[model samples]
Target: MRLFLCEKPSQARDIAKALGVRGKGEGCLTGAGVTVTWCIGHLLETAPPDAYDPRYKQWRLEHLPIVPEQWRMQVKPKTASQFKAVKRLLGQASEVVIATDADREGEMIARELLDHCRYRGPIQRLWLSALDDASIQKALAALRPGASTFSLYHCALGRSRADWLIGMNLSRLFTLLGQRSGYQGVLPVGRVQTPTLRLVVDRDRSIEAFQPVAWWGIDVKLEAARQVFIAQWQAPKAACDEEGRCLQQPIAEAAKAKMASAPSAQVTDVRTERMKETAPLPFDLGTLQQLCSRKFGLGAQETLDIAQALYETYKAITYPRSDCGYLPMSQHAEAPAVLAGLKRADPALVPLFDHINPGRRSRAWNDAKVSAHHGIIPTTVAPNLDKLPPRHRQVYTLIRARYLAQFLLEHSYDRTRATFECAGETLLATGKQVIEPGWKRALPEALAAQPGREPAQPLPPLARRDQCPVRDVQLKNNWTQPPKPFTEGDLISAMKNVARLVEDPKLKQKLKETTGIGTEATRAGIIQGLLDRGYLTKAGKALAATPAGCSLVDAVPRAITDPGTTAIWEQALDMVQSGEMPLEEFLARQSAWMSKLVERCKGLNVTIEGQAKAPAWKKKRKPAGARRAPAGKGRKRTAPAE
Candidate 1:
């Protein structure tokens, strides 16, 4: 019998349906000589410190940095039954096919289960990008030997081990320290979470320290035949260089002062040009989260959850957890069909997609740009709206709308700018008028105006050298605002590792080569973990680090807090995936770094007094209903430290 192991039960059901398997039994579906079983997320997890040593269970500073000589794995208590079912199925089968998601984490989920279950047999890998019926059939027909997925497994294993080394060791160290300081809580820390928290804290610090300074600019307005025109200030011909950088600010200020002193101003020149803006690239996980946060007021984790549900439950979209914002070239042929599918489900988008021409030029659709998975788009399975929950339907609509818009014509608009001079002072204004609302008409909703902001008014047309009367003139004083706090949206954008923020070019380039701080799949979770541990909190859309969070980062050695450390590890992991670097080398480097960090943390003098209180995990638990005891009737009971 052939046994099929899938990442989750939903995927297994899909596979079974595709292969026409109908017989259902405990933990599996059987038919056509195939037994399909599934794992419920993670069946085996990294063993806790107590699994290494009983003494390690006690939260003592003496057991600081509980680095296991060799990591062990055990079935997670909640999923032990599922693991046993899969093990029994694997034992009875003549061969096994690994039907898991084609990604690093998914690969780890399958391999670890098999390793823990002690399954040894000829194995094959079912690799498919989408869960749609056609994609599943193709993958099954072209299944490759399981050995083909070894490199992927190696990369996944390395990632898990790296996270474990950092998460386990640091969580223990911090929790123990918090307990010693008379606080009760789990001082949760991880390789990615710590750095992510540092980002929020640092941004807050920058905003707090910012000091505003005043600056002035010359404006010009000209009148021609009852029409007004705006022109550039000219700036005494020497202040600005060829590239437009003001070589001397003082000279420019003097020039502005002189212009103000003059009685009348004259128009120097007028230039008008038309520019075209192509539609935005397709939605990747990061870009989609950013857009949803900015547009729908959705948090990063909320967006991820919505997108995941759209992908898995509704089957309305392809993979939601992708980094690349480009589709494969081969998918171009299927665009029309996919759009048609969406149109049948969403009639509102039909008009927007009617004029779509598949030959449009968009770098966002380039196949070469795609990595492990293509950008998120509607799957071949047309969304069954009747079956979708309200939230899933909304998210599915978002995916379908984006897919249709991608094939539509580019949005065209006329961008106009004018400069005017009056009383020797220069004034400038600009306006944008849509000439053609092509793909933009299909947008999910109209762009929302910011709070306290009025919609921009259109400017009237004017000619060069025209003279017009000035209705009013006034100076507007504006303070230099501090850096804005990071919303979940902004944090995700920053985490994309753009490197533009880093002043050093070398470090920036290295960051690009490493592909940002963490993979798209892990970034949101890292942020969420920080929040769950009280290292970060939400104030409206912005993320603010708690006092404990700030102090924990401040107390940690600089090496642990540096984003470059994560970047370097990412580079090494990439090399391992590509077969250019050995897993042993990467693991050795990680171990060395871990040893150094443990030593450094051991010597640090970190105190929590006056800082944020430790989490509840560190707090003592009181007896149930002890608080309800009659006053003065019973001895006061003290809660023991957790």
Candidate 2:
């Protein structure tokens, strides 16, 4: 009998349906010589330190760096029944198929089980991105040889082991160190979560240290041929700051007075240019999370959940964990069916039918840019919008709109910039007029362009050197605002674009090419981990680092907190995936790195100045008149410091 292994129960059901498997069995679906089984995420996780040696169970400074000579995997007690059922099935199978999620983590889920069960049989791979019946059927007809993606297991194993070395060694090291500093909270750290925590800590520090700067500006309302418009006074370079904000209050006041006294101004230049803006690419998980956070005030994880429901539960969309916003060129052949289904999914999209031409293609359809999974899009299966929950409907609508946008014309507009000279002051006014609504027609008002800033109004027609009467002049005072605190959405975007945070050009390019810190599938969980550990707290939509969180970043070594370390790891993992670097080499380097961190930080004396006192464990106090060695080494040392 042939057996198919899947990542989740929902996924197993979808694949079983495609294979005409209707009989339900004890932990799987079975029919006519085929049995489908699934894993609830990973049935096996990397064994904790204590699993190797009972002595390691107690957290001690001496047990600082626990690098395992031989890694072990244990079946999770919560899902042990499912593992047994899978093992029994593997024992009876003549051939096996790995039908898990189409990514590195997904590969680990199935391969780990295969290794544990000691199954040796001919294997095939089912690379699926959508849960709809048609998509499942298509994937079944084009199965790949298991060898094509065999290296992916090594890459995932390398990543899992690397995370283990960092998380186990570093977390214990820092937590133990914190205990010495009178901090009782456990400082849990991970390869991705640490750098993510540092991002928030650094942002919080910047905000705490920010000092607002006061500035001034002048606005004049002018009337030309019974048409009125507003223009702002342009500050000279010497009187302005680097960002072009006027810094001289006196100069701004003089300009306001001079402009108020002037009766008329002559327009020096009126340049009007037409521009075309291509439709935005379809939704990648990161961009979708960012938009949902901004528009609907949804958390990153919440957005991912809604998207997952749309993909798996309702079959209204394709895969949600995609990092690429570009679609495969071959998939473009199904656009007509998808469009027809989209129109039937929601009645609101009916009016957009005329605007959407199935033949027209946008830049989103690119073969080379497509990743493991294409962008999130509507499937050919029509969904009943009324059957979906309110949030599901909202997310599905957004996904549908992006798909509809690909078939519409480009958004076109004419931009006008008018410059005027009045009472020795230079003033400028700008306006935009849309020539074609085009793809924008498919989007709701909330998803419209420039949703945050005030929209530009239509400008009155004026010729070059035309005279206009000054109606009124107003002096406006402005303050240079500090950066806004990070929202959950903002943190998601920051994680994906961490290259911008690095100062080194080579590292920046590497991060950019590798698609930033965490994978699209894991960033949401990373942020949630920080929140769960009390390292971060959410205020309204903004994420703020707590004292424990900030202190953890301060206490941790620079190598662990810096994003560059993770970027380098990602590069190595990529090399492993491509078979350029061996998994053994990657694991060896990570183990060496972990040992060095423990050695360097084991002897240091560190303390967080303000916090409740922890349990006494060799507390030491300085003598009143003792001379300090240096400011850096002046801290009173405490025994049992990690």
Candidate 3:
């Protein structure tokens, strides 16, 4: 018998259905000598500090660094029964195939379960980009030996261990300090969460320190062919000319002299060009969250929850947490069928599908750009729209529309710019007129509803040297604005390896080579942790880090606070996976770093007031079954409390 282990129950069901398994039993489905079983989230979690030593159960400054000699895995209490059942099934099977999601975390989920269950058998890996039956079938037919995923396991293990080392140690350390300071809850901190909080805090500080500066600009209005044209005097030129001339002073002198001079303004130059706006790349988790937050006013967590529900419950969309924004080359053949289904389900989207060429060329569709899994998109199966909730219906529609839009003809527009001279000063104006709406027709509402505020309108078209009448002219006052606080949308964008935005070019190039601060699958959770710990708070869409969060960052060592640290580690991990670097070397470096951190924190002072005190001395208790009755009390037998 062969056993197929999937990451979740929904996935197991899909695999079983594809394999023609119709019978379901305890924790598994069986048919044709193949048994399919699933794990819920995590079957085994890293053992707690108490598991290493009973004394470590209570939070105490004296027990600051709880480093285990060797990390142990314990079955999660809620999933122990399922774990045991899967373990037994794996032992009986002749071969096992891992049918988890094709991503790093998914790889970890399967590998850890196998390691914890002590399963020894021929293992095969089923890797696919989508959940559709066709993709699954192809993956199954082309299964490779599990040894191919060994580096994935190493990367996963390294990630898990690094997170564990940082999270467990820092959470406990901070919790003890909080308790000592009379705070009631754990001061949660983690490798990813802390940096995310710092980002918010830093943004808030920038906003707070900003002082707006007032400046004035000259606006010239010109009338041409019964239409009014507007242009701004290039502020720097208006302030001073090539001969150190001040045009503003000259204008003021003209008013003082009462010399009504109708400045003859002419269009000095005109430039026109056709520009194409290609469809946006498909939705990765981060990009999807950003769009929903910026466009639909949805929170990051809310967007993720809705996307996950659509993917897992409705089965209308592909995997939601993927980072790749391109489809696999093989999926190109099914584009038409997927579009046909979308049109059938949402007839409103028909017009957008008319120009779709499955072979459309765009940087967004390159096969070489993908990693782990392809972008989130609609499956080939016709969606039962009625089965999904209203919000999920909206999310699914967005996903489908985006996928269809990708194959459609690119949006085309005519961009025009006009240069004008007034009062011996040059003014500039520009406009973009849509020549072909193309895919943009699908989401007109999304385009119309500009949430925050309306920006100034574009200038009207004009020919070179054409004379026009100025209806009105007014000087406008403007203020230089400070950097805005990080909206959840902005933070999501910043977190996607934006080291290029930093001033240092070397750092930017290094970060580009490594995957960003956190993987797409884990970034949202890391953000949520910051909120739960009171390290950050949401004011509207903007994130503001709390004083405690700022202090925590100040307290931590420089190496840990820097995002480049994670980037460097990611580069090494990638090398390990590519067979260019040894996993042992990475582990050794991590061990050495961990030791240094432990030694540094050992002598650090943390003060908490009016909280539960740690016990100074430990007492040994008898074995569970060998408890004795108190001597002074009645000889009556006492039972253990339930």
Candidate 4:
């Protein structure tokens, strides 16, 4: 019998329905000599440090770098029963089909199990982008040989082992070091988590060290035919900062006084240009998470969870773990069906139906720009809007709006910039008049506001040399503000575009080529892990590093905490995925680097000054005059001589 293996039960059910597999078994469905079974994520996981040797369990400096000669994986106890069911089916089958998520991690999940179970059969891969019946049927006609994706497994394995080496060894090394300093807390670290934590820690440091600089500005109100508009005084180049902020208070004050005393102002120049704004590309997981965090106050992980439900549960949208916001050219052909489903999904979309052109093509459709998966979009299957929870409906609406935007015309406007001379001071005013709302009309005005923009006020028409009365002039004082603390949305955006933050020119370009610090699927989890470990805390919507997080970043080596290091690893992993670098070679280099790190940290003499106090649950007050207990006999040995 031919067997189908899937990543989750929901995925299996969708595939089974498409293939007409109606008979239900213990952990699978069966019909017409075909069997479908599923894994609850991964049936097998890499063995922990203690699995190699019991002595490794005791945290000691000597056993810092634990590298196994031969890596091993064992069945996860929680999902052992499902593993048995799959193994039995594998034993009886002559052919097996891999029907899991289309990504590196999914490849590893299936390939690792087949290797462990010793399944020696012809294997085929079903690369489905969506769990909808039509998508499944389409994918069924084009199954790739399992060998075609075998390299992805190696790529993923290399990443997993490298993360393990760093996390298991470095985490132990730092925890032991913290214990020696009279702080009894586990200092957990990882390849991605460490660098991610450092980002917040460094930002906090910058904010703390920031000294606000005072600046001044003057605004002049000019009136023409009963219409009033404000014009900002432009300081001379020699008296202004690089950003054109008037830093010389005397010049600003003089300009304010001169403008106030002036009887009239002459319009020096008025330039108007028509501009067009293309709609934003559709949602990739990172972009979607960032938008949800900003608009709905949802955390990164929370956004991913909601998007995942829309994909797997309701079949309302396509895959949510996509990295590219560009759609494949081939997918453009299905826009009519998806558009029809969207109209049926919500009545609020009735007005937009007249504007959407089924054949219209936007810049978003490009085969070359598409990555592992295309952008997250609506499926041809329409979901019942009334049945969806509020959060789900809100997120679905945002995703649908972006897709609808592709069929509409570009937003067009006329931008007008006016320059005036008043009392020997040069003043500037700008305004925009919309010629066509176009794609912007598909979204609410609040949602369509550009990032970091305030509402613009429309201006009255003006001539190049027309004169106007000077109504009012006011001097305003402002201070340069420090960088704001990250919200989950801000953090997601930073991770996605981390190249902007790197100081080194070469490394910055490399990060840009390789995308960013973490994969779209894993970044949310990394941020969540930091919060669960108390390395980060939430204050309203802003994210802050706890004292422990700051202390750990201070104690760790710069090389490990640098975002550049993670970017380098990502480049190497990409090479592995493309077969440019062998899997064994990558692991060997990682093992050597980890060994040297452990050795270097062992001899280092450092103290964690101002360590964060233990959490209240772990804090206890002893009787007065009672001495604190020593950590252990090994504490003195672990500490270096001052």
Candidate 5:
């Protein structure tokens, strides 16, 4: 008999239907000598330290670093019955098939059960990108040998064990030390959570310590041929800051005085250049989460949940947890079918039918760039939008728009910069005129605003050496504003772009190209865990570190809270996946490093600072139209864009 092990019941059911399996068994579906069983996530979990030796549960400092000689995994109490069913099938089956999500975690999910149940048989792997019948049939036609992906399992196992060692040892070590200092609350540390918490703590400290500096500027209104435009006065280098904000009030006053007296401004130079902007590639999970947070104020985990439903429940999209945004070249052939299905599902999309070209291929399709799975996109058969929930429909639209953008033309425009001179002071005017709104038309109304600089008002036609009559001149006082608190979207972007914070060039580039401290599938969970543990709090849309969270950063070694170090470990895990390093060697190095870090901090005095209160996000939002008046009115100038 052939046994198929799947990651979840929904996944198993989908596959069973595709394969014509109709008979149902206890915790499984069976037909025609083929049996399919599902796991509710992982059926077994790593045994805790106490499971190794009951004495370790008491939490004595003497048992500080609980290192197990022979690691053990026991069946979880909640899923033990399913485990038993799988065990029975594994014992009787002539061959086994791993039909799980196509990722490292899924590999571990199936591999761990095989190891635990002591199943030794010929194994084949099924890599499915979507639960839709068409996709399922495609995947079934190309079954890969189990060994082709076996390394992913070891890589995932290494990460799991490393996290266990770090979390189990360090959390106990700090909690005991905190107890010694009279703080009763348990201090939880993690491989990724600690660094994420530190990001908020560091940002809060910077905002608190920032000092605002007053600056000066002058805006002049000039008119030529009845067209008026604003020109900014630029101060001389000696009296200006690095960003050219006039630092000395006297200097700005002097320039404004001369410009006000002048009757006309001379245009020294006029330059215009054509520019084109390509549409962004479809989103990976990280980018999708960020956009959802920014546009809809959805939490990271909430976005992930909706995307997962779209992939599994509705069969409306491909995998939602993919790390790659580039599409596989093989998928481009299905574009016409996907487009037709989309139009059929939603009447609102009918007008765009003529504009979309299925033959046009964008830069997003590249076989070499795809890894395991391609971008999350609409499946060939689009589900009925009327039946889908509102949130699901909105998210689906966002994903669909990105894919549709690939078939549209590039957005093109003409950028113009005009330099002016007035009474020994330099003045500049910039503007842009849109020639075409290409891919932007594909965006839904809610996402049509786009993310970038505010479009400049188009300047009236001008030539070199033209004199424009000055209408008005005003000198302005502005203060430099501190960095704004991070929204969930901002935080997600920071976590993914953490490479900018690292000083090393090689590691910096590698991490920036790959991923940051966490995988696309786990970053949301890490953030949600931090919130549940009270290490972080949410105010409106902003994230702030709690008192306990701040104290934890100080108590632990800096390396533990460093995003760079954590990202390095993520890269090492990649090495394990590529078979560049043996799993045992990777774990050995991790164990040695963890043991040393634990030893160094064993004797430190620890005092955890505050009690954890309920997270602020759960509270009702205040009514709109409430605004606190500022002390005085002054235009604020922001820092230049990086």
Candidate 6:
């Protein structure tokens, strides 16, 4: 019989339904000579240090670095039954189909089981993005050869081993060193999580050490014909700061007074130009998380959860873990079906439909830019809006809007800039008059405005070299503000754009090409892990690193906390994916690097001055009313107290 292995029960049912499998069996669904089994996630996990040698069970300085000579995989006890079911099917099947999440992690999930079970049968791969029936049926007909994606498994395996080496060896070496310095906490570390923690720590330090600068600004109200608009006093270069804020208070005060006394000013130049803005590309996971945090005040993990539900539970959107914001050109043919479904499911979208042109393609549809998965967009079928929970509806609305925006015209506006000579000091006024709402009409009002600034006001018509009255002059004092504390959304953006923080030119270029730091699928979890471990504290919508977190950043090697180093690893993993590097070579280098780090760090003293203490292991207390008999007094045959 042919067997199909899937990532989750929901996924198995979807694929099985398309394959005409209706019979339910032990831990699987079966019919038409095809058997489908699933893994809850990964049924197997990497074995711990103690698994190799009993002596390694106790944490000691002597056992600083534990690099496995021969790595082992153990079945997760919670999912052992499913493992058995899969193993049993593997033995009986003539051919196998691997259907899981279509990513590096997903490939690892399926291949690891195959290796452990010694499955030597012919294999195929099912690459799926959306859980909708149409997408599943389409994927079923074009199954890829197992060899096409075999390298992805090796890449994931190399990452897993490298991460393990860093986590086990470095964490042990540092925690032992910290204990001698009178600190009581296990200093756990990982390649991604530690670097992520450093981002928060560095931001917190910058905010505390900030020094505000005082400056001055002037706003003059100008009147033309019957219309009144605001104009700013232009400061001279010698008396102004780099950002054009006037540093010399006397210069600003004099300009304000002179403008106040002048009744009329000559308009030296008037320029009007039309501006066009294209529709925003649909979301990848990072951008989605960032916007949700900024607009809805949702946490990174919370946004990810809602996006996941929309993809899997409601089938309202395509895959949410995608890293690219470009859609595949082939999928453009389905736009009409998707748009029609949106109109049927939501009445509110009806008015917007009149503006959508299904034939008009946006730049978002590009073949070369598409990654492993395309952008998160609406699927061909839209679920009832009323049936979705409030948060789900909010996120779905955003996703649907971006897809709808693709077929609309560019947002067009007329920008007018007028320069004037008032009381011998230069003054400038700028205004915007919208020519067309265009794609912006698709966005909800909450997403319509720029996040940090006020929208531009329209200006009255003006002519070059015309005289205009100076209505009033207001001099304002402004201070340079400190950097705002990171919101989860802001932090997510930081992780995705980490190249901006890197100073090395070569490293910066590498980060930009590789898309910096954690993968879209794992970034939310990285943030949540920091919170759960007490490494970060959240206040309102902002995130701050705790003392323990800050100490960890200060204690670790700089390269370990450097995001560029992580990008280098990502590049190596990509090389493996392209078959340019061997998996054994990657692991061998990682092992050697691990040994060197442990040797260097083991002898150094680590100081941890943090408020949150890592709890020391405590002996279990005796159960109430079940205490042992007084020392050696009743050793013979006394009944235990109950």
Tens-place lDDT per residue, model 6, 1-642, is 999999889889988988989999999999978999999887887776778987776678787678888989898898899999999999999998999999988898999999999999999999999999999998998999999999999988888778877877677677777879887656767777788889899899999999998899888888887898898989999998789888899989988888899998789999999999999999999999999998889998899889988988887788899999999998999999999999999998889888889998899999999989999999977989888999998999999989899989999999999999999999889999999999999999989999788899788889887888888889999999988999999998888899988888888888888778877877887777677657889999999999888988899998889888887787788888889999888888878887888888877877887744322211244321121111101101011100
Q: What is the C-alpha RMSD of each candidate to the true structure, in Å?
A: 7.0, 6.9, 8.0, 5.7, 8.2, 7.4
| Tens-digit lDDT string for candidate 3 (1-642) | 999999889889888999999888899999989899998867877676678888765666676565667878888788888988898897798998988877766777888878877777899999976677876898899998899887897887776666666666666665655545555545545556566666776777888999876555566677777767677666454455454334465554443222124445678998988999777777888888888777677777788889877777666788888887897776777777877777787666666656667676556667788877789989877577787777777777777767867776777887878887665666677776778876676554664335675543455657787876655666655566789777777788777865754455666666675445766766666666566545667888778877766767665666666676677677778887887877667767776776678677755555533222111111244321121111111101011000
For model 5 the TM-score comes to 0.93
Using TM-score as the yardstick, the better of models 2 and 3 is 2
Go through the candidates in order and give the clash count of each: 24, 0, 4, 0, 0, 0
TM-score list, all predictions: 0.86, 0.94, 0.87, 0.94, 0.93, 0.95
Per-residue lDDT of 466-487 in model 1, one digit per residue for the tens?
5455433323233456888998
Worst 10 residues of 2 by lDDT: 630-639
Q: For residues 1-642, write the lDDT of model 5, one tens digit per residue.
A: 999899999999999999999999998999999999998887887777778887875777788677778889888798899999999999988999899889988999899999988888999999999889999999999999999999999988888888777777787788778889887545667767778788889899999999999999999999988999999997888888888888899989988999999999999999999999888898899899999988888888889899999998989999999888999888999898898888888898787767788898999999999988899899977888888899998899899999989988888989999999988778999888899878888998768665665658789999988999999999999999888887777777788888888888877977787677777877777777677667788988888988988999899898888777776777788899898988888888888998999989989998888965333442243321121100100011000000
Deviating ranges (above 4 Å) for candidate 5: 450-453, 613-642
Tens digits of per-residue lDDT, candidate 2, 1-642, equal 999999999999999988989999989899999999999888886776667887876778897688888888888788899999999999999998999999888888899899988999999999998999989988999999999989899988888788777777776776677768666545566767778989998998898899999999888999887989899899998999998999999999989989999998899999999999899999999999998898888988889889988888888889999999999998889998888877776777787897789999899999999988899999998788788899888888898888888999999999999999999999999989999998999888878967658888678898988999999999999999888899999999998899998988888988998788877887886776667556788988999987777877788888888999987888898899999999989999989988988999998766653442222221343321121110100011100111
**In model 4, which range of ten residues has the least summed lDDT?**
633-642
Give the local distance difference test score of model 6: 0.84
lDDT of 4 by residue, 1-642 (tens): 989999999999999999999999988999999999998887887776677888865778887688888999888798899999998888988999999889988888888889999998899999988989989999999999999998889988888778778877777788778777776556666766778888898888999999998899888889986899888889999987788888889888888888899998899999999999998899999999888888889988889889999999999899999988999998998998999888877788888888889899999999999988999999998888889999998899899889999999999999989999998889999888999999998886669887798666677889988898998888999999999999998898888788887898888988887677877887887777677657889988899998888888887898888888887887798899889999898999999998998999986554554444333433465421121111111100110100
CA lDDT for candidate 4: 0.83
Q: Choose the strongest candidate by TM-score.
A: 6
User: Which pairs clash (backbone N, Cα, C closer than 3 Å) in model 3?
Assistant: 180-608, 180-609, 181-608, 181-609
Return the lDDT, model 1, position 520: 73
